[model samples]
Target: MIRRLAAFARPFSAWLAASAALRVLHLALGIAILTVAARALAAGADAVATAGTIVVLAAAKGTAHYGEQYLGHRVAFTVLARLRTDFFDALARQAPGVLHRHRSGDLAARATADVNRVEVFYAHTIAPALAAVVVALGSAGYLAAAAHPALAVISLAGAAVSGLAVPLLGRRPVRQAARRRQETRGLIAAHVADTVGGLRDLALLGAAGRWERRLGALEERAAGDTRALAARLAIRRAANTAVLAATVSAVAVAGACLWRDGQLDRQSWWAAIAVTLAMAPALTAVEAFAGESGTTVAAARRIFEIIDVPRPRVPPPPAPAPPGPSGSAPPRPAPPARAATTGPATTTGPTIIGPTIIGPTVIGPTVTGAASPAAAERRAAAVSARGVGFAYPGSPPVLAGVDLDLPPGSTTAVLGATGSGKSSLGYLLAAVLTPTHGTITLDGADLRDLPEDLIRRRVALADQRPFVFSDTIAGNLRLADPGADEDLLWHVLETVDLAEAVRALPGRLRTRLAEHGADLSGGELQRLSLAQALLRRPALLICDEVTGQLDAATEARLLDRLRRDSAGRTTVWITHRPATLRAVDQVVVLDAGRVTTPAGPRLSRAGAARPGLSPAGSPGPASLGDTPGPRGPAG
Candidate 1:
């Protein structure tokens, strides 16, 4: 709570101090005016001078009040704007997995509405509260010594009750209300995002009305909480108000008694009244501040929650080293072992006793020749998985005791039906997620040893459907090669057969892509992703059924170029299509997280017409481990 409030004053600490000074000046003048009029009455000074003193005090108080309010608002808005930006940046930097716990509406509340509500604290409550305490204490002390001591004590009692005691009493319930309100806002934002994202599906299925009803119910609950919070605040206000009136009345009674005792003359009587009146406002200021503290504390807690979430654990060893481009010597192939997942590829269910029979890899004889075919294949240990196994936070193992290899300058077809862990495998290779067991090596170096960004530059994956940000055709193309010259960008487009489409745009490369590439056709987006992948000049390109929906002719054309461009460049093809399987060099089959028994050309389907393998697509169920996830196609 303190940090967030202080943040509001950061941009205008000078202004805050100035506003505070003005508030003090206003209060001082107000009290001074009261003293002057009282003295004028006692001394019987000229009427003009007395009236002028009162006028000056009124004018000064008016100006100071306006200045404090104006400056306070300025600071509040400036800080709030900065806070929103910082909130977005923080959310963006969070690990993808961590976002699962929060609701969109709750985040929005803290970022937008809740933070905005705290404006009063920055602009008015804080400065006024400070000035109020100072004024109240000063007046009480002055009147007690100079006018009426008992009256001063009475004012002091009221200030304590209003400032400290009453507000503290309401803190807990108010805080909970603020917390609930914040959560509701974030939940609402998330619901909106989800509903909009699925609008088309919902409309077709006639479920939009049902969702609307659910959203209405959620809104109603929020309203109920708001009413409860407001009602509590109202009660506190009424109680504090009564306390304030009684304290002021008590001070007045004390002044009358003092006058009767001849301890306070007429001048002293008026001065005591004025001081007590000045102190009265302080109690109200204190009350207001107390009421706000609860909600602010809850809001602060929500913000800290995001900042304090534990980061994803980093595995030991290192990410694999990025390999040289297609033209360079392939690094020495080590056995399947990534330094990151250091533990033995663990299998939870019934460990294989002896002779683990890890997958076989053709580790060609070592040679010194640089140009020979054997030398060219030296870099071919593109990716090797040794005893690869993984289980989520509390779920059963999705993959267990698995070993696999994809060599350099070769096309390896990865076939799996839905839920076959195909996408999880892709994510692991991409270094988007770290494995829970075993090791993954690229070009023979442990992947855990190398920087993930650098590793991905050498290995790119294209999902079946990928997001295309709204931008000009050229702008989108430049994502992979930020510094690519115009000619190079056009060349990549031509390679992916998107050159003609791009040129046909009304604004050509300058055409706006619209929100999320709504202006582009599905095929155009796929081609653009391919162009981006090509521009990276990756050694191992992974295409995860990217052409799943393309027609035969279009698929053939894209596939033809893929094979030609991928020559001597390692490639992994994940497809269910017969044509894609025939285009690759070899096929590795997976079933139930392990190469099935009878694991040669066919698996999964029994007595089913076999799809062609390398020569002809093989027809057996491809290994299905995890769902195909939507992810970045970064090499």
Candidate 2:
């Protein structure tokens, strides 16, 4: 982690070097000014000249101070920006999977507050330490040059005691307090965010007071830890100040003794004492940094923890083979190869090579002749899962030995009681989660071997509780299709039966929504989410309880339009709704973590009377096994 942090400073190395140099210049000028003043007072030689020299040194010191501050801050902010970008990139790679293990507020704290703390390491710690070393060595050299080697040794020893020993004495206690403070801060932030997001629910449940108590407890712990850390720091500071004063006094006394022994003249003795006094401020700066090093190091460790999360193993793109001797038929474009050899499964297709929008133009090939466009569209993705299983780390499996197939253009409904892995199955089928025990394939290509972009373009999932950003309607829809025109947006809205509602709004597509669609009715949010998904026109659409908020009439009408709009697309409807199941070609029923009815129920798209039940309007076992369903290992 230390080496990685040093790398961030590399980009601003020039600025950092200049800042350190200016700091050294500023200290050197102060020492020179003191020496000149002492010489003029002790010898009464050229007072006017001495005064002029002091004025020049003072001005130069002021200029160096300004330059040091400017360059130091420039380097600090640059390194900070780099750290933030790199940390976020690392977090993004682990998102939705590894991030689930962390608290949102804790992660937020790491990103903002923890990262900000690292500024102390670069801006206050490194360059200041370097300047202190330079000033200390220069001060000792000047004393030795003035025939006071013994005093020089004394000065160096004093610096070591103040800068090194004082910090070491307080290290353990300071570190402990800092770590506790950081943890408590994260806890409080997480609690506050959770409370705000669920304030209404907490009030309705009459549990807001309990949450308030919990928050107060966390804040109090943080305050107590901070106070303890401050008290320790204050004691350390007092000890360092006493040590500095004693060292200065020792230098003056040692110089007087040397002068009495005829080893130094009056002017030389005074100059030596002045240099030691100047060295005090330099050593004090080092002591100040040492006092805070414990907190800075603690913060650095937290930042590294996020950066070191193991990224998902995405295989590199395959390397192209070398060309044969000169004139061979310009090698035919190689077939879409699988991911790198490290991949567990082979994939084949027209590998998407660049930023290509996913729409009708990029979907898989369509079957011609008798099939309608809708049927052809559904055939674009032939997804299958073979003996698949999933489990969170250290927990029992949530899904086990599940086998399923979603032929192109087919509508499949997955049914299960609460906590029966229905949503897990949907996530797996949509390529959001990788299977721990088996393979899931899209068009005969392992889902793992497919690039993230291709999977996002080809498959769309409407979450159970969809997120609606606070933006204009057009802005929200643009997330699905960035290049979509107003016409295209209206077309999708109409398809989802939401065009009328949006048109009635004061600003139409320009209407802004509150966070999470707080400004819209629950049903309107659902339709809006459906509209966004339809805009993608993905090859496979996984709707996870998308219609749970809709009335039966709206749900039926939306499902009918979905059937028509997604003609050639594969639709996986995860629901327990009887009305929704009747329109699909097949159903998968899960219990616990296993698929209890693997074959599931089959319904004729043209003849089903009830949505999810049997012809007699009852959810009977006969409806589940009436016909053989798609059942086999994933291709």
Candidate 3:
């Protein structure tokens, strides 16, 4: 695990090596100054000369120390920045999908706190550990040659006790405590974020106090973990100090015995003691790192967990087949009238690729003999689905073997009971979720083959709950098309029946909205989302219950505007309301994971009753009269 974390530092190898070298220089210089000063004093050397030498060594040591710190921090901060970027990139690769499994607070904690904690390894641990080992061995070797071999053993013993033994003794317990502390901190962060985001809802439900108490409990657990870790660290410090004292006492006694035996001179005896004292600073530095190692490792593990997530891969486009004898490509087979429902499906056409684009587009070959001249002029892309199925991770299938063939410039409504996968279908169509089985084609091209930017530019989805940034009205709309001008903005707003509402505001288009559009009514917020989507002039527009919050009059007016906009674009409305049915040209009903319609003959014109949808008179399994509940995993 440590080796894996260290790999991230490979890009900064030069800086790391320089930092470690400076640290070793700083320690060696300090040892040299002490030994020279002690020997000079014992030999009654010139005080001025010794003082000058000491001053020079001290200056060099100070410079080395500064360089070590500068290089260490520079490398640490740069790695931190890169780690943050990689983390977000990982999130983007699996998003909307991963968001269902991970909490916002936990992810935020990993990004901010965990990544910051790993800095300890770079700025504090690496160089100091290297320096301690090098200085300790050098000091022991010097004592063996210049003073007494026995004294060398004492020096090495002291260094080992302070730098290695004490840390190893407490490693397991300290590590466990550190891991617990990190987990607790993540939970606390998640709780705090959840509390703040839903404060209003909690208050209205009279559960604010309960939520506050829960937060307090989480904070208490974190504090307890921290205290456990600190206790282990305190014990290590006490043990290190006792070991140092014992080594020093043994060194003093052995040196006196050697002097009595005429094996050591006064000058050398003093120098040996100075050498033993020099190991104190380096050993103590090592011990500090030991106490922090547990925390550092725990933090690094969390960071790597995110960084190692595999990014979604886009498959290579299908290979084109050789032309037939007539010098023309053979006609592709038509999709199955109804999708098969056994375990895995047999693909009779193009191989299916799951959610590969950032957004959705309906493209490819035109529906032959179906699109009229007026509809063809609209330049809308044809959307078809053959045996498409979808399921959330570890959940039941939401959509299975569902077939759709929406012609260009047509309006279709998809209706389903709660958990019937209405929203899931919309998301699949938008390329936000991947299908578990079957292919979804835009024109003739598989959605997986289209570039992300092209799909985003051509497709738009306006759902019931749309995120609104805290910015001016015009600023928010510009997110859809950054280059959209004021006139075009107003025109799209008018298309969504929101122009008059904006004019009534004090700041008009410039009026700032609170986060998530909290300042606006639900209907206005829905309209705002619709307006943004319309501004894109997408080839295919998907509105998932966008008018659920509006009054009948507003919805009526908005639908009227949508009909005008629909003249030149494909539209899909996913809803359960009977009223929504009146605005659509055809209706498709989903039950359990299959598409079913009242017995009817397939029609030829775009938006006419087809194999996938029931005609106006026949009722599907889920009648419009059924009361709609909260959407499920299928949704």
The Cα error of candidate 2 at residue 419, in Å, is 1.0
Which of the two, 1 or 3, has more TM-score? 3
| TM-score, prediction 2 | 0.80
Q: TM-scores, in order shown? A: 0.72, 0.80, 0.79
Query: Which stretches of model 3 miss by more than 4 angstroms?
Result: 311-384, 406-410, 439-458, 535-540, 563-570, 577-586, 598-633
lDDT per residue as tens, model 1, 1-635: 67666865776889888888788887788778877887788778899989988998899889988887788788878876766776665675442333445655557666776667767677767788778778878888897788867787888888888777888766778878867876776677778878977898999999999999989988988898898889889999998888888886887788788889888887888777766666656577777777777666666667666655532443443343343342222223322221112222322111111212212222122122312242234233377876666544455555555466675565665655455455566666665555677778887877767765767577776656667777777787788878888887877777667788888878877787887687777777777787887777777777766666566667766675554444346777776555554344455444444433222333221112333222223223432212243222211
**Tens digits of per-residue lDDT for model 2, 546-610:** 77667777776777566545655778887755566545555566656665533223333322433
The models' CA-based lDDT, in order, is 0.64, 0.72, 0.75
Q: Arrange candidates by TM-score, highest first: which order?
A: 2, 3, 1
Residue 132 error for model 3, in Å? 2.6
The residue-by-residue lDDT of candidate 3 on 200-266, one tens digit each, is 8998999998898998998899899999999999988989888888887788889989999999998
lDDT of 3: 0.75
Per candidate, the number of residue pairs that clash is 36, 12, 8
Q: For model 1, state the Cα shift of residue 27 in Å.
A: 4.4
